[model samples]
Target: MDCKSESGLEMQNVCIVEDDDAVRDALAELVESDGYRVLSYASAEEFVAGADATQVDVLIVDFRLPGMSGGELLKRLNERGMRLPVILMTGHADCDEVGLGLDVQDVSFLTKPCDPRRLLGLIGAAVDGKG
Candidate 1:
């Protein structure tokens, strides 16, 4: 799946880190259809273990995971100096919790059942350093 820009450059890679199988699969399909290379993980631990953090252009992470929370994962990434744009998804729309996650400059929060198009656009912006 080669997604080219106007200058004929390949699109960046996007990683989806979600616990739900259905959501992971669906998000992967949607992102791939948008012309970006997509990788899916069932948990934050799996993603952090398997994926090359440097290769990741954007990360779509669910706030609640089986092992570690999304914010915890982000904190780890920060400690390692692994900088990447992250979009956080959560079932809870708590302003305080979301605000805490937003303390990271490159992080964004999305409520559950997010619009696919908006998600894609945000991914694009993240990769382009425009978010």
Candidate 2:
């Protein structure tokens, strides 16, 4: 389903699910600047309850959230038959531990204080069905 933005450009809708207000805002701004429409959420549960879930082309989630973890959210989405691409972000230095929590085949895991360019690249890959 191709979605057109008000600017007349093909816009990919991305959902940013993070508990931290600053991180969410920053991520939203960055993604928007990259020409994608972003919907920022405070938690996985909040995103799950919102209508934007079905409309997003990709989901950018934090590994640890207040209500539900990113992995758990992925599990729930899978069970519900939603095939949205997800990217996990974490502040932890242990990639192995993060790997253990994520079981999805195409998930992209990035460390916290993520580089904006790298995040944009990952998001493009995800939206292009390459992640």
Evaluate model 1: give its TM-score.
0.86
TM-score of 2: 0.86
lDDT of each: 0.83, 0.81
User: Candidate 1, clashing residue pairs?
Assistant: none
**Which ten residues in a row are the worst by lDDT in model 1?**
93-102
**Which digits, one per residue and each the tens of the lDDT, describe model 2 over residues 82-121?**
7778888987754656676346536888898878899999
Q: How do the predictions measure up, each by TM-score? A: 0.86, 0.86
Quality of model 2 by C-alpha lDDT: 0.81
* Winning model by lDDT: 1
Root-mean-square deviation (CA) per prediction? 3.4, 2.5
In Å, residue 118's CA in model 1 sits off its true spot by 0.6
* Ten residues in sequence with the least summed lDDT for candidate 2: 96-105
